[model samples]
Target: MKFDKAAGENTLFDNAEFVGRPTHRIDGPLKVTGTAPYAYERHDVVEGQLYGYPLGSAISHGLIVSMDAEAARNAPGVRAVVTTLEIDPLEKGMNNVARLFGGAEVQHYHQAIAVVVADSFEQARAAASLIEVEYEKGDPADYDLGAAFERLQGSGEMDTDTGDVEAAFSSAAALLDEMYHTPSQSHMAMEPHASIVDWSDGDQMTVWTSNQMINWNHGSLATTFGLDEDKIRVESPYIGGGFGGKLWLRADAVLAALGSRAAGAPVKLALPRPFIMNNTTHRSETVQRIRLAAGEDGKLTGIWHEAASHALPDGRGEDATAQTPFFYASDSIRAKHHIVTMSLPESADMRAPGEAAGLMALEVAMDEMAEKLGMDPVEFRKVNDTQVNPSNPEQEFSDRNFVECLDRGAEAFRWTDRNTAPGATRDGQWLVGHGVAGAYRGALVLPSGSRALLEGGKLVIETDMTDIGTGSYTILAQTAAETMGLTLDDVEMRMGNSAYPVSSGSGGQFGAASSSAGVYAACMALRERIAEQLGVEEAEFRDGRVIAGDTDRALSELEGQIDAVDSIEWGDFQSEYQMATFGAHFVEVGVHAGTGETRVRRMLAVCDSGRILNPITARSQVIGGMTMAVGAALSEDMALDSGRGMFANHDLAGYEVAVHADIPEQEVIFIDTLDPVASPLKAKGVGELGVCGVAAAVANAVYNATGVRVREYPVTLDKLIGGLPAIG
Candidate 1:
């Protein structure tokens, strides 16, 4: 049962001193001591900044008959009131999936129609309520995903089929077909999208905002405001959390810029907690059908996953079936995408996107097949291990450790002690169960670059990748320090600024790998520069300096000679091999005997991503993802009021999240491995790994515990009350 290989077995990154070592976040002191300035927290940047408050629509789907801003403008401290009809089109944001409000048409409830600028935040918010608008309300379809989703002409490179799934299932010896629904989920990132915008000296603009992708905004905001990209600069070094929400332009960022331009002064805007749910983006709910065809031996012969999600009228599908085609090998496989147009809030990327929701159904199906075949779920998946993408048989995995991940995880959890029977293991009033699901995430690489400055014998790393509390600063520094053989204190790292070199921009779990690779490239450039400074006839490295035939001086001594090249830049690494992160998530849970609430008892994850730049921070990313999946699987769902087309449970008090009582002790392991294909440092993304399969494992465990299969999300106790067997 012990599947952990020796320390040197398969690891690519764990062998290095700095790679596996546990290091505290380099920005920890500044953040904990309140020195790190967030977007709305910076005071010296703009002295006369006004607060902007957005007025959301009351009607979900409607044409505005009239908007009266008289009362709003008359309110205390209200300076300027801009409504959708009043604001003319500067332009649209290129990367924005949602059409931001303007021109008198309500797409969804709480769509921003007006921004009330006032001297204080509270004053602006109070005045926002005074703006009245007449609407010719139209019928809204919110809870009706089944009907609205059929309109999708379904276009994308996403759909494919190897062999006919209908034919395979019809002839298969065993089959499991089921439907699963995941509800709309809010990112609920602690930092509720805030921004401060100020323009200066005729054409130049500077903004501070809470966002994970800085380069993206540089272009999107410039286009949205009809300005040159070079004139607009954004900076935000410390972000609370994004969970994939801050990857694109949110309302605060846009509204602040518009308000600032109109008021002829800086403006500050942060969506009210009540308005955050509807104003910004959230993950779309998915109704996925998973059909599995297996032989008598429990080996899957065919896998079919079809998912349809509701999106705002102008939006694209959530693409929830992205990972289904390649997850496991099968003779026949098909994955389909369907988008349904609706008048609901815009659906944007959440952590793990397609894979997270898809696995909630697929993993549970694998578990069900294990139940039907009377085989251990772990054993069942291993039996059908696939090395190549079933949909594209031509492309094989560069490295797939999922099989070993499950083997090692099962050994660590003592999974053999688990019984396949429902209502089997119990501790007095508590029912005990263990369930696990394999985790699969595609490796993705994005174009990124970083700038390095070697001055005063210190290495400075600069990239525009926003940290978002992900320890990006610490990891990038570690990578630089490793390459240069410098100590942590000797390396200074700066990030989250448009002025810095463009980065991959911190989403899709690609920030760590992509940004660090850029840093690695910069460091290599520095080594070459140092060699030139030392006048080294042949390439040579020595004690923070270079030597030309034993004639070397301290790197600091070359400061006077290196006027033309104090800082070096590097780019154009996109043509390299595809960089991707991979991992496995395992979960265990308990269902309350009478209440039916599912609680995660413990969790384990094994990641085989190449060299981890910072083990401590990477594991933190993994655990954070698991925490989110825990809520998504059990208690998190945005309640939609169909008649109004608005999220009813608007406040934090009503929306349940996983607290300390909900989270169990979690263990993570990294199979020491490096991919030369990735980059010189050879690392992979771990941000979204913990999110991938944690939910389905818990849901599958609840089934193993109580024998109830409730597919609609939030697995509330009421849904399980009637299904629980009579207790002793």
Candidate 2:
């Protein structure tokens, strides 16, 4: 089934029994009962599974001169030891910028230099420590992003340019020019990257891993191991959390595979919490310079955003200018992204990638610009709203209710009651204020395939899509049930197996919509087959029966089971329509007068991401993103040790994330709308949308409370203390 044309009235829209309802996650019972088999907990699947402990490079950047592993190999219960210098560097995986393992050169600190396999994890760790390594240290690597940006500025071409931005800025009635900084952040997922690999079947390898994209991991493992794709299988039925950190093939899977191959037994490996930070990907730090020009009416006249971000030599920097061109209306707009190579650990996608960091700067700039024009921030955004892409007037959004989101959020949050003057409204030592920021995350639908089997009146959906704690199972089951006119109990979902048809996986928040469409396509094909077998031209699937004209038959009455496999191949609808998810974040905060401490009083997010598949899970995703956004805005920062080229606070103890006590009550509202161009389900992604622009809202709230603005991220008390209002 090709999704080229705008979706007409489909079963999901016409006969939605469970699609829009607040459905609990189907795997909830298993998760709470401690029966769900996470990657590291699947010990019963393979026998005599050895534990593999990776040895990280001591030097941040250097060449491994020599390694003496004889003592470790002869140590207690040591089955195998694979060193980086033992073999040539493995081919880099498709999604990897840093080499996972192999060769002598170390690209970043904590690069896996070797893996030690033993009968027990303790033994592996002990033996790994005994392996002595020497390195020829390289010259000091460039670690300063600020200096790098200055050196690399204007070295690359601009990513976007429109009307004369300088002229418009000069002629504007009001203007705002400021620089904002967002530091590197860790995914800090509860479940670290863990994997169990079994190569006992000779060339056939099986990997049970915590990865978001199973198909991509399967192929990357095949490429990394120099084997055919068919010989490898990747399964991830349960993932604790990914947050885009598990979107790629990490060292755990590769090292486990290598250990299993060498030891001739299954090897299970879980990266230590500290190692997970430098070993895997982190959100790139960004420096953004934004210039916004607006008229007296608070209408934006010009917008120029220039962002510089650091990455590895082969990596693309954070695209912090992504949403600027189409987010709001501006006559003259120029957005540029500058990449500066640094020796920091690989900085890649975290949640929301570009828009998350970009909006932190862009949306705050909007707030500052609104204040300069003496206009309400919400009204300023509303005035500059663009239903059509500002860069291309002919291309209009498939569905944009951003204004509605703002209105709804403002009403729900009681925006009118907020203290209009900073430092004027105080309760004891606390000063209160309100702030708002618009959210934008592009909608994406990728080609996804699934297979359906109907046996004994039960429908089974098989796809490589992963749940990633996003409720893929429940929503997919709902999609299958809705499409086949069966109850939720009658549908079964088998996902996160590479053996199944390739799916969109869990990244980019596209998994639910795209994978569900694949299931719908396969189920639609089964409906066709069932109707054909019944000698009916067309059939209406309802109440577990197929009815067409005078022919009626229960699905169970069929002689045998029916099966169908299909994929949703997308067309150029994106070319004709700019598709994106929009939202508005409203936040209330109180800042301490003397200590400069900021505490969120409450938060509300109104989303306009087309249809809601399952309001329950969808709200969970939104609040979860909002919680993470609080971390981004107030606490989370992967402090870099510039001298060592690694995250200084690599562990949970040192790095801060928003905890239960840190977060206030959060509310989420979804606009009632559907984008036929998005998918058959008419649902766009809400996961990333939840995070975008939230930090800016929080930052704006802080500024409103103190009358002082902090452009740097993690708006900690240290950055606010001195500038805060004098005590009393």
Q: What's the lDDT for candidate 2? A: 0.90
Worst 10 residues of 1 by lDDT: 1-10
> Candidate 2: lDDT of 562?
90
Return the TM-score for candidate 2, rounded to 2 decimals: 0.99
Q: For residues 545-583, could you state the per-residue lDDT of candidate 2 as single tens digits?
A: 988999888887787789999999998766799999999
How many clashes show up in model 1? 7
* lDDT of each residue in 1-728, candidate 1, tens digit only: 11112113323234454655789998999889998888888888878989999888888887888988899889999877888888664466855765575777777888878888899988898998888889998874556875544443334544877877778798888888887888988888877889998863467788899988998888888877778988999998889888877887777877787777677889989888867688778888888878899888887788877788878766764777877777777888878878877787888888888888888888888888888888888889899777766776666665667788888888888888885687788876778777888887766766677877878877787788789888988888877777665677878888899988888888887787777767766766777777766667654443565556767666666664231112222233322222345566667778889788677788988887876677789888888888888888889989988778888888777777777778869999888576655544556788887788888888888877888887888888888889875842
What is each predicted model's overall lDDT from 0 to 1? 0.77, 0.90
Show where candidate 1 strays beyond 4 Å.
1-15, 148-158, 537-543, 561-580
> What lDDT does candidate 2 reach at residue 381?
94
In model 2, state the lDDT of residue 141: 81
